[model samples]
Target chain A: MSPSSPSFAVEFDEINQEIVLRGTMRVRSPEEMTDATDLIRRSFGHGGHLVYVNIKRLTHLNMTAFRCIADVLTEACLADPQRRIVIVASSVIAWSAPLFETLASAQPNLSVEIYDSAFYPGQTFVEDESFIPILRTQTKMTWRHEREILPRHGMKEGMAIADICCGIGDFATLIKRQFNPTRLIALDHSKKSLEYARRVAAEFGLNSIEYTYGDASQMLLADNQFDFVTCRHSLQIFDRPDILLRELYRICKPGGRVYITNEKNSHCLGEPHSESIRWTYDEVAKLFSHFDMDVEMGPKSRRLLTDAGFDTIKVESFMVTNLDGDPRDFADVIEAWENVYAGQMAVRRGDSPDFIRRFRQGFKDHVLAALHPKGYAGWPIWAASGRKPF
Target chain B: MIERQVSPEPGAFEQMASLTLDTALFRSEFHLCDRVSEYLADIVAQSHEDPARYANFSSQLINEMIEFSFRSAVPTGQIDFRLLKNEERVRVSIEFAPVSDHQPDWLANDTSAIANGHPAVGDLWGLADAIRVNLHTEEHKENHVTLMADFALLEAVR
Candidate 1:
């Protein structure tokens, strides 16, 4: 194995409990594939305890190599039904965990978990006036859309609505257009974003949507005034989400719904190994636990509303995909992301510029050349909504 | 300011692929051309391995079209612009309906027919792989025109 070839490098742990596979591995022929299988079997080493195959150190992960590794582990599990295989992959990789999970779904002893090496989600330069539209386009959203997260939450024709931390007011305007809320107040603390939102709304000749500037944790709006309260993709920015949630609950009228959607893949996908903003469902549950909320949910929907003391909670997921192409449209989106990523990294104080530049280029190449043709290029948008007690 | 009623909703022109310049003759001036040209150059620079040649023509094409719109007989409501990717080249297409019945003579004939007399018009042939223009007098008030200029994308630009 060439030390710096970036194709395949294997390092076995002295304890023999774990094996770290690094770099992009491709099997050119069946012989090479068989060799990779033998190496993985060697790593298992007649083990009775759970064996870990760590792909977290891989610079550019190749799924083919991992599939081979998974096959070896499956045969091992057949030999010893109690032997467990833990595949530790970086949180940034889109397909690694899912692909492994699918492979392991059949076998009882195999599992995949995201290593907590994600970048810290921060108030990126996305707050800048110019960036809001490009970011929204990445998610295939407009100022207002007939198709939305609103009607699904039971928004009516003329009820009052408030969008907290509503950067650029895209979702708020969308709700107003789709549902015709009697009073649509779009609120955000950032002057730049609020101004942009106001200008956009004005451009649309929309006078009904009101723009207010205020922090989510300390909104000046009255309680029980809004029919619906929503905050999307901004929950991670608050120093304390618990305070914001309590405020969301306070302002929400009895039986009114509160919806919280986390942009999971956006925050975690392409996250670096050094930092983590990959808030797991458990982390989200723990974060809200301080406020005595319990939304231990499913893959797409978690019952955060139930934890927030709301009855009749429903969790829904929205995903935008089949965009551009594998390398073509995907490359463009990644480049658009690169436009904001450096500034976001700077905001988080995460990695050095050198490291970020390298990762950005490497990820583009990996996605373009090695990733599956119909791979995961989208973030899982999970929304949890529940009503206040009537 | 032009009465451009565009919401944050995705416009026909979105992202780096295209940008719409829907301003009145009084607003755009020479500054619009320079600013948009610079933006196009930046896009080409970022997208191409070697941007020097493609960037040059993109600026020239943008300037001439803005000149074409500015010199139109009447004020036009909107002139749409897009940079599209063809199989082998990038096509910069500009669509607008000028409020004039008299077709612009510059576009009436092949650019080379008057190349010597109008060097700026002559430069079009050198800068583009193909120049396709569609002009039809709309019965309402304006003459619809679509100018599509294809530039060399090479292996680098894609």
Candidate 2:
């Protein structure tokens, strides 16, 4: 089909070993375009190859459209065990970039190449050779962290685990691969994220897992369903942290373990920067303490466990060094901190651009200097676990 | 709080309409139609001194009352109202029909139950009282009046 065609067109490029899709895949109301794409993809039987979806002529799209594309790509990748799928798009100019990135991260074999006119004028395709290095770097970093932490917590094979707030199944996938868990139920709120996770699981041939979408606070799983519950950087966002803890307690089997990790003085861990942040932290802290759990502050982790409730509570501290020792890592940390500071300042000033830019730049400089080798700044993360009494 | 002279040549319709408007504007809590009836009765009782003038005033008042009520009840929406006379009384009825694509799920089931209860009954009685008060009032003493009102939900058949 031509680019102007209203319907979708699929063709295989033998030279590039890529499957090229053109034209608007959006069909009329109620009819899913992904279903049509799937039919075409299956007919071609091109397994483990790069898939380039050219949306240059596409004017409109929604979550459903992205989901459909993800489904087709996932199925094709799964069918071919040896090959991987690489996605090439024009740029992150489209709202669908986040959705695409989310899917790529979830699907182990799927890599996305976003083409920018300024970055690469004519090259709009993602090559397999180009993606391998980037993929290897990310995988090694993630795997190293998981391996370091898993053994410390005594995570063993055949353990039934619940991964709370499993965003796109990044940590969940890592945990499953390293620990070789018998069953891994990855839970997240975003349906699109879960769809991506499903794709990843399919691509990796990891079938011993289930994906669920809902609020973790109201997880519908049966009580005592999991031998272990792991939450990574998710506890502080809860309206009632104690309620979540109690829910975790109820769901975990007797003698089961619960692990939670968050960076200290980090936005993700509910640290306060201003009055508003303090107020939010106070409310969250109140919820965390309400469940009658004993609290112990460690060098890395502020551990909370109850002898009356759980048999044991242990808190461990660990440092993650950037093996590359790149200054960009420290810059990224400062940038994240600056973003939080600027956001808070903006709220106070009613979103004035002058105040936001000034505060952000100042905060970034201050944080960057602090994170330098001799600056006495180190990223502090806390990991704690408790065992429910049998 | 303000007083005005009643018009002469008031008729039964005029007395009823004036009573309806007066009751709606004054009473804080009363059945809707009963309030109208009461106002009419009050005007009729007081208009003995200048019957013709009060009669005329009452007719104009009732016309204004009907116009105002019709506008408010329908409110530029698809709500339809009809004034019907049966035997000896004038009955003003209002019907609200669901028109939008997103209709409230419980509207059909609850409207019937709501219409059957004392709340709707009280509103109808208040309207009647207003008519009665106006007919007996000094502004409409020469006119005789009867008033009633009912509410119902109408579903369109496919």
What DockQ, between 0 and 1, does each candidate earn?
A: 0.01, 0.00
Best by lDDT: 1
Superposed by TM-score, candidate 1 places the C-alpha of residue A236 at a distance from the truth, in angstroms, of 2.2
DockQ of 2: 0.00
Which parts of model 2 are misplaced by more than 4 Å?
A: A1-143, A266-303, A322-330, A333-337, A340-359, A366-377, B1-158
How accurate locally is residue A226 in candidate 2, as Cα lDDT from 0 to 100?
80
Model 1 ranges off by over 4 Å = A1-121, A142-149, A266-304, A324-333, A342-354, A362-376, B1-158
State the lDDT of candidate 2 residue by residue for A220-253, as single tens digits.
3446768888876556444345656765776787
lDDT of 2 at A81: 48
The TM-scores, one per candidate, come to 0.41, 0.39
Per-residue alpha-carbon lDDT of candidate 2 for residues B32-123, written as tens digits (9 for 90 to 100) = 32223223422332322222122222322232233223322322223222343323333342233222321222122222322554222222
C-alpha lDDT score of every prediction, in listed order: 0.53, 0.45
Candidate 1, pairs of clashing residues? A118-A275, A118-A276, A119-A277, A144-A174, A293-A307, A294-A307, A295-A303, A295-A304, A297-A302
lDDT of 1 by residue, A90-191 (tens): 533323454567557778888887764221123434455656756555434312222555677777788878888787777776677777888777776565
Per prediction, the TM-score for chain B is 0.60, 0.23
